[model samples]
Target: MKFLADNKRTLDALNNWVPNPIILSSFFWGAGNVDQRSIDGLLCSLLHQLLKAEPGLGPQLLTRYPEWTDRATYHDWSNKELETALFLAWDLPTRTASLSSLLPAAEAGIQGSMQTMHF
Candidate 1:
């Protein structure tokens, strides 16, 4: 699967490159919890968190965003809670999240946040 493919790419890139682990932050549309429904967004979100946490990446920082979920939803995701939420929301099968949805949602969320921050 492309998800695994991309994860492998990023992980391999991270593993082979021995350094202080500075993530080149993506121009993510928003902040707070990262959107991880797709590889592109996942890459950016991971980079953002990595950069935010690692002093070597840049200045210390944090992010905010919409459809709030954490970076763990990427590599560290577990399905049970989400499945339970779906079950509680509706006693029917839910469509998988769209790979296309993440960017626009993130953009809107970020724009809202930036406006709030008066940037």
Candidate 2:
């Protein structure tokens, strides 16, 4: 997966063939880091990438969850919140292609997460 992500020619070809394509890629580790393999972590990482690609989504996210910008009251984001944010980013008109590589052991949890998101 990393190889595919690093291939500029392939990425360029994909973008050319797909209209307004936004490529999102993520890799999960299974080195006993629960957070890295959790749905919350996955959503957070994807949301970060999405926001970087489209700053327009930031305003909407802030509007939906204003406390996100307030460190004083900031808490670990719930999976629901993160999922909602990801959905919002995903619902945009632009086409998005997601490529995720996860360890076999973490498949169930990740699949459950996607199911909840109706992905």
User: Which candidate tops TM-score?
Assistant: 2
Q: List the residue pairs that clash in candidate 2.
A: none
Report the lDDT tens digits of candidate 2 across residue range 74-107.
Answer: 1366667777779987886556777777667464
TM-score, candidate 2, is 0.77
Candidate 1 Cα RMSD after full superposition onto the native fold (Å): 15.9
Model 2 whole-model lDDT (C-alpha atoms): 0.72
Alpha-carbon TM-score of each model against the true structure: 0.21, 0.77
lDDT of 1 at 81: 35
lDDT of 1 by residue, 60-81 (tens): 1212122224535534433333
Q: What are the RMSDs of all candidates, in order?
A: 15.9, 2.9
Which lDDT value does model 2 have at 90?
A: 86
Query: Could you tally the backbone clashes for each prediction?
Result: 6, 0
lDDT of 1: 0.35
Which stretches in model 1 have alpha-carbon errors above 4 Å?
Answer: 1-35, 59-119
